[model samples]
Target: MSPPKSAQRLENKWDASRAKNMSEPEKLLYRSNLLGSDKRITNYGGGNTSAKVLQKDPLTGETVEVLWVKGSGGDVGSIAMDGFSTLYMDKLNALRGLYRGVEYEDEMVAYLPHCTFNLNPRAASIDTPLHAYVPARHVDHMHPDAIIAIAAARDSKALTQQIFGDTIGWLPWKKPGYELGLWLSDFCARNPDARGVVLESHGLFTWADDARDCYDLTLDIIQTAMDWFAEQTAGKDAFGGARHQSLPADQRRAAASRLMPAIRGMVSGQQHMVGHFTDSDAVLEFVNANEMERLAALGTSCPDHFLRTKIRPLVVDFDPAKPDIDATLAGLADAISDYREDYMAYYERCKHDDSPALRDPNAVVYLVPGVGMITFAKDKATARISGEFYVNAINVMRGADAVSEYRGLPEQEAFDIEYWLLEEAKLQRMPAPKSMAGRVALVTGGAGGIGSATAERYLREGACVMLADIDETALAETAENLSARYSADVVRTVTMNVTDEAAVVSACSNIAAEFGGVDILVSNAGIASSAPVEETTLDLWNRNMAILSTGYFLVSREAFKLFRVQDMGGAIVFVASKNGLAASPNASAYCTAKASEIHLARCLALEGAPMGVRVNVVNPDAVLKGSKIWQGEWLDQRAGTYGTDKDGLEAMYRDRSLLKRSVLPDDIAEAAYFLASDLSAKSTGNIINVDAGNVQAFTR
Candidate 1:
């Protein structure tokens, strides 16, 4: 069996002249993209590829053959030349002779630095030696789900022989290291015609003179394994039991939002961690399958998954149809504690004196009886990665269970890989991650100047943001621009009128359901009204208060309720105005409403203190460039008050402040971001004035 011709995306497109023109690194990178783009082959950060290149050392001007392997933490799907770590092949190959019976910790990891060809060496993948020993032009290693299905089966050796006969060589469970690579090289030496080898309970490897041949060989072998698996399970239940369906989408979402917070509260230690909810039809079906508890507890599909998700996932039993969600959530804390205690016992059972200190005991949690899975981690990327790997595990395990019993590596082997020094070094190689990596921040009126800028700043700090505004077009455009700039799906848009209590409640629920819970709220939406007290009509006053005062109350009230539910402290910043502190003639309505919103923040701050929630205010004046409030009649009225045209009013407003500078939205956003971040952790119920020293608005 082979992949359909159309499935071959790595077909040779290069003629002799084109191949001559392309650099070796470019050719290798092109093949990496072709192989890594398909999830059937690899998941995020799970696979490595390498090319043996002959290049002249820039410093020495000597041509050397170096093994350019994928660097640790580099995704093969978008790998660049810099993503590879160049190591001298002779030095890397020399280690194979000295690797006899030595602890990988003391020799392999410590000696890797001596093998590098470059002065500033990037950390290479742990499997670099595996490629170096092959002496092939190109090598590809991927944890394709199809191969894992067969490799992790109960009788994996027999299945390996049955599937590919003599073409595939099989190695029993061994933690990846210099020894494993040596054994693989010796096995291939014995079988000179072997297409590849199946590292039992791990992954697959294929090699050829051409990169395309190597990639295609991987695909062909995997397709053959998949066809063999399909034939073995013909007319049988793929899931191995009766399938169940989940609750309706709306009910399922409601249940996730209501229950995820309790899990977050119990699992998050001193630091706050966010949960991400994800489920597909396949995931739901797997969750609903009979005996899922036993199947999911069997361990990960492969060892690399252990680095992201632990060896086993924590499964919680619950019924989404039950109306008593609060009762369900109450019992979850005890269950989570039980899971932690069990994890510690496992750690103690497998401890070596040299093992790294125990990692955070919490593992990704899986829910059943209606809702799907919830992944918990220090940040959003890790959480999503954990969830994704587990989802892949479900499919692979099902495929294995369909033919024979599914089996992962024994607990001891898994422990060895999890605490391996080479694996642990990968984390050390990564740069320090962002501070707000996993948080959720929502900005009201996010289409406006200050709100949009604040959202952008949060995104830069690694927080996923939700932009809420009544203007759907502007909100969508802002989200698009931010997404393009960041090259991430970190921002979402919601059309919301903050004054409507129902809309506010629904929006908050949606945000919680999407990203676990809200970590920060910027209550920045408002309208500006300018009129003399005698000319201020009932309609004008009502409209002004509705947006400025009532809107703030509604949004803040909902956020407060959610924060209490999550039992996690959050930050709230209200964007007030300088006019709130100092009275201005002919703008009684605007000034009064602004003052009301500021006091509203104070009142909420006092209430939220005991729970660790912080509330603050940012007062900015005369941000004319992007301020929607400064256009139309409001701008005309303010210019008239200063006895100047609109264009000259900026200077007049600047002259009124002590610093003699015009305020901008970015200035106010910086103040709000500071208050919402940990910088102002202890300071709440405080106002940050961004008006360039307005004496009238000065506070002692």
Candidate 2:
């Protein structure tokens, strides 16, 4: 359909000058990216695009028509040239001769590798046949929200006809594979001049001989749907009008922070799960609607929507007006159990003889009336993306429900797609998760050397790290560097003074909101001073005690609070010093604070044991290379006391150790990681010294 002139029209982004110099494949990539740039057009990793272009055959030196389609599991928004799979058109067509029927469509996937063009390593997705069999030179299969609102409407076929006047066709929902590709081919052959077709309860498909025309048609078709809906539902109250008022933004997040941890504990039994919360305007509109619960129970129609969000969302029994958080927490177990039981029942009702073993059965999405949505997955990105997908579903429901009744896929069909054998194979083919895959850590004094090293190590192991430090500049720098190496998703930064009790509690809540809950706490924040018994002032003593001993106590206490809320076992690593055990001249205040830190760790270890929260210590001596404590008065004072200059003090500490080695920040970080990791899971109330065999600091 040619979209009408309306204010809701999509921006036409075609740049003639830029495209004038591009190859055919590059133009295809450009079109795909432009279409995918807007979530309203298509969602992340939800759709596929393809082009048929003539290329010189690498093996035969002959001109050939190659099918370049988006590879399996690649997102069009971020895809590059290498993301497309190239296959010979003739080989793809020949597979039509091999198609036994719709019953045997999955068998055709194994033959795709045989048809590779130029030996491209990118595997062709199942949608390859959908693109290959179509007669057009370019094809775009998108799940635009505006068009899907029409596609998922109760009378989808009639709506497609009314909007496009037979210019764009319609096909009932069929699982994508060999048969559906053939269905599209038959439709195009019959409706010769049609611009595209709407797949009922699915998405939109547009095609043209030219890539630019295809892009234009795609934008126009989706815009027409948007404009048409805009006119049809001009004055209507969406979702039968909002049934409840939205909570204030602060209150909304406060509720999510309270709920995510408890829910994570219940759902993370098989594998730990990370969480994401959204209170966006659209999410608020949907969750606060009168029809929200009914529409949610119907589930999502689009395969990609339900695949990411699960069959249906669980409507959390929370009332914003009552503000009963304790009641919500108390009932969460029963709510989640009911959801799991319902999912398992669906599985039993829909299982085929060879269906894959029942999967996690937990709902990926949770909807809280007057609050918003919460989603959980094995990692942060997935959890975030799942929330985004649900928002897309929300948009679809609003549009469809306004003009026509919203319709979800039948339970049997949703089950088939969710449990498709091919999908199970894809799931099995994914690489094993990293060891610290689903854990989150908070590193105090994270701007310093040992702290940054520990954060990086945890990030490398697939854990999310929230860096908390008193120094804002250093904290930002450390977070930026680590984020550059290990994506921004897994690393966050907060300016925190560990000795501040309120700051400690707030940081704990922020981490809960950012990555769901906390599992590891590395209390590495510290300060050092040097003075004889007579010269040690009360202020100096108090400063050292406050930062080293009391700071550790504050962060650990807050972490234990989160631990109780989550019911997940926790690991706490306190970075102390060798001075805690060995008496050194002219450092009474420093040694006393370090000794207090060690004894505090022992007491916490005894208290945390019954709750499965482990507490341990890493003590280091003279970690001078990148140690922030070594940069000030302590270095000069220690040098003067030992008859050495500033440059020679590090060497003195090295020589003082029995093994004669200098301990760097990374070395201390390694010991902290070991104690915080499962390597020392069986041991607590213990100290691992990274001080190169200091005899006097040895444990008894």
- The CA lDDT of each predicted structure is 0.81, 0.90
Quick one: best lDDT, which candidate?
2
Error of 1 at 157 (Å): 1.6
Worst 10 residues of 2 by lDDT: 1-10
Model 2 stretches astray by more than 4 angstroms: 1-9
Model 2 / residue 456 / CA error / Å: 0.5
lDDT value for model 1: 0.81
Tens digits of per-residue lDDT for model 1, 582-686: 999899999999999889989999999999999999999888878888879999998887789998999998998899998998898899889989889999999
Candidate 2 Cα lDDT to native? 0.90
Every model's TM-score: 0.94, 0.97
Task: After superposing candidate 1 on the true structure, give the runs of residues whose Cα lies further than 4 Å from its correct spot.
Answer: 1-20, 57-63, 104-106, 118-120, 321-323, 487-489
TM-score between candidate 1 and the true structure: 0.94
